[model samples]
Target chain A: MTTRERTDVRRLPEKQVRDVAVLHAILDGALQAAVGFQVDGQPFVLPMACAREGDDLLLHGSTGSRLMRTLAAGAPVCVSVTHLDGLVYARSAFESSMRYRSATILGTAVLVPDDEKLHALEVLTEHLLPGRWAELRAPRAKELAATSVLRVALEEWSVKVSDGFPDDPDEDLDEPVWAGVVPMRVSYDDPVDAPDLAPDRPVPPHVRALLDRS
Target chain B: MTTRERTDVRRLPEKQVRDVAVLHAILDGALQAAVGFQVDGQPFVLPMACAREGDDLLLHGSTGSRLMRTLAAGAPVCVSVTHLDGLVYARSAFESSMRYRSATILGTAVLVPDDEKLHALEVLTEHLLPGRWAELRAPRAKELAATSVLRVALEEWSVKVSDGFPDDPDEDLDEPVWAGVVPMRVSYDDPVDAPDLAPDRPVPPHVRALLDRS
Candidate 1:
């Protein structure tokens, strides 16, 4: 675990450095994250498809992206992942809240070295579609040249989680209010096989497995 | 609409602004959002239940919060909402991307005046669980005093969205690759009625409707 200062403790109350397993679970659960940073004194945030590769996160963009260029210049960046578990219906409107788990990482991003970019790309690819990497063609040199990838180390981070029932106000507990949780989840629907897919080419096992869980 | 200067786009790309409707839809559809800001040179991000109230977003926090104070003091802030539409499987590992719609609002948040706090709270409650304000007990004076609500005007905002198929490199298009979209959605499970509820007290129609859609 990495040790870094967490300056704002009130909004971000839980500052415990999460273990690697916890961090991985949070990253794996959310397929996308909001990446926030300041470019020329203006705050800019862009959501990108991301995957965790060892101790860093792989974020990709077109080579001409201003976001990529700003990050490459060693500007500070913040990446946030959130999962809404349930809606907390409290006895009073003021006490209503959501049960959720979120992780925020603040760090400087470095452009991935060419030698390691391919592997990072593979991590992202497999993360998006398991078993598809081996079936797909590799990137040509020029195509790879046109893309830029950055790895932001997850060093200074915090995870704030709120779970279970709503914290109803004492006076409103017996006010004839119906209060409970409405569970929220993310799930996949049946895959729509590609229109161009050959009739004989069956859907791959990895893709089929997702539907089975549903 | 409130014509605040912060809502005015300074360096915003014209093409991106034309897609503003898509951004509004993304924010409306997102179940959760990460609110980010800096306090004394340190960064913090918190996942909060949010709702769009007119042209602004309503975010609730504890009245005694250090973060709310920082925000009310005119510190820079970023609120981001994202919906992961699908996982885009591509012909090459480098071309794999996720179909998503995201909006980031950059501005300083203003604390909702005490007189207007109740209306803001109602907007949040109604947004999370429709008809919840009427179903549940209203906040007492002290409870209302104990909570703080702020609104971040969505004036200076940008929405980035990508949908449909992956933009894979041309050379990899026919390489025996299975490329398509794995659609994702956020859903609500059946609401759990409170254990102490009276048998005659039926679940409200608003709550019951979300069950079948789940």
Candidate 2:
């Protein structure tokens, strides 16, 4: 599949993936993104909480911020999400690399209308905290007013996956060094109660569910 | 201390950090960064292996990549490094957030000249793989030729940290919901040997050192 000039992974074209499912998989498993936008010909990239809803990727931002204002006004943005899966240790420094699943989406973000803002908020909150959204109180009107939800259609994007073992050349194979992948993953530590929390409050099952993942 | 207009953390001025040591600490502990650069006003953010050497942040890229080529020509770039430390579960979804250490550096990236490319390469490799650099064979000239090392001065940078407990309002305190942080950390799984490796090869001490860290 031919991608537009912008979404093309020109550096390692072989690693570029055109599959929509792959793109969704990367987005579905991600909660954060480094969003890039240009201001006065200079690029600024900042971390933002994100969620994918239907065909659009939802990004939560402060309405007062420049990036959010620019994005809400339809400036082009690049959202990047990456999962560093492992470290590939080859026999030579040149051949050593990382195993990762990376996705980049390019689109202008449309501001969620005032009426849809509440639903967008639920998606954003639920996407990050899952079941906790149900037990939480509704967002205050003031809180909703301060939040900005920007949705970028997932129409133009690219995904790159590099998950193989060290691909050292044949000449470097006999170098008598161990070659492999040191797999990496994110895990949750025990939930720590807030300092002011009442002593009687037990940790919620929803939060405990985070640690249940093997 | 006043920061450059570009480096100002305008979104939440209170979260901006000025200490150079804090900036270095964020960079030192980080290996992956989302580097943002522009072409014809369209911003692009790509993940790259990074290392901080003294006052400069070194980013590794393929010579043929558009980002590298643009940076090599002294185009402005923004490099963002973030460690998502934990999930903050507040009583209200509006107050929930994440604990993170995020740094943003904005500057023009200068291409490391040919004479210093090897040293830059070492910093990049050693920063990511640490002791593996000393154990690996040297990078061949062709390999060196294909890699581009761009250095962005840490001069124009801002670090924002959000590591505290969820700051729910006083009125929301009695909501009878568990509120706290679910800490997150990255850990390595046992190393998996390359399929082509000899069965008798043992994992190196340097690689095992990775797992030894607390």
Candidate 3:
């Protein structure tokens, strides 16, 4: 949160939203986030699975990875989560755009100490997979050693949403062409059991619930 | 492609792929990409609609924006496109991961000249909207003036794909617990016409084709 002024959306100011709930909503809805960080003035962005817990965004990766080690050591980072909701079909190619909700956070991360690491993992698992966490076995000590859990606070952030119709000029709107939004969404297919799973084992309810909601 | 060595995937070398076809497939399947660029020592990653034209990744935005102006002027950039195919369920949390195909291209962008701007726009439109570009009206001169088109070559890049089942150890595999991948995909619902459109006008074929594919 060092440079607070940089978080403002200068391109399309009207799309900029100042609501914390909107930020949290976008983060909660997204499964992964693109994290940007610089090393020796060169920027690197990698996609990582993420979950939101309270006012923080939880990220986990192999402790051996350079990104995890650098971020865990409190390097400045930019985390962004975007959802492309739909495509806006305008009468003119210039006015065409996409409907999307995005949230970007600017700050460093705090490593989850060894004592609280398990709880943090639990929070992440439950948020992403929901009821399946309780059904799964506990993580072994060796498994925990190889992973690093870090949390970035939602202190300095900006959320921008473009969900409405395209703002075409009055002249363009009168054209005989058809124009509207083509809605898009994430859908889940049937669960594919592992080849190693016993044939008698049935798909869990929590997993089925995901498809139902979809 | 300034530091050529930096393009190597040092973290997960096993997942790193050197095939150009894989990179093209990943970029073609994705709708947007997270572009990272450094200003001073601060890093920023923003999601932008992207299209792949030959060996170049085409990007367009308002010429007035700081990012567009900076990237258009040949600033170093790292563009990443990731498609999360499914969630991998493993016996232990340590071995779990997502099935994804990601391509990272590192280079500076070259601005498309005024003469080629319209062609670049057409390429982008056709890639995203498919057959709709032929039906849409041509871009006016004013609209072209307000936009900036830039293309980044896929010269120094890396493709990483993790599409297999979880790589759990032999001991963990013996457990009777079920584990597998829950497939995920982007689906489209029925397209809704604009409220301002003529009530009798029917939906276009190209837009409907998208839903059919989904």
For candidate 3, what is the DockQ-based docking class? medium
Candidate 2 residues lying further than 4 Å off, grouped into runs, are A1-3, B1-3
| CAPRI class of candidate 2 | high
Model 1 chain A: worst 10 consecutive residues (lDDT sum): A1-10
**Model 1 docking tier (incorrect/acceptable/medium/high):** acceptable
Report DockQ per prediction, comma-separated: 0.48, 0.85, 0.73
Q: For model 1, report DockQ.
A: 0.48
lDDT of 1 at A204: 74
On a 0 to 100 scale, what is the lDDT of residue A112 in model 2? Answer: 96
Clashes of 2: 0
Which of the two, 2 or 3, has more DockQ? 2
What are the per-residue Cα lDDT tens digits for candidate 3 across A96-139?
Answer: 88899999898888888999889988887777776767766789
The 0-to-1 C-alpha lDDT of every candidate, in the order given, reads 0.72, 0.89, 0.85
Residue B120 C-alpha lDDT in model 3: 95
Q: What is candidate 1's lDDT per residue for A36-121, written digit by digit as tens?
A: 77744455566666889878888877667767887898888888888888887777776677777777888888898788877877
Model 1 fnat value: 0.53
Give fnat for candidate 3: 0.67
Best by DockQ: 2
Candidates arranged by TM-score, highest first: 2, 3, 1
TM-score to true structure, per model: 0.88, 0.97, 0.96
Candidate 1: residue A103 Cα off by (Å): 0.7
Q: What's chain A's TM-score in each predicted model?
A: 0.90, 0.96, 0.97
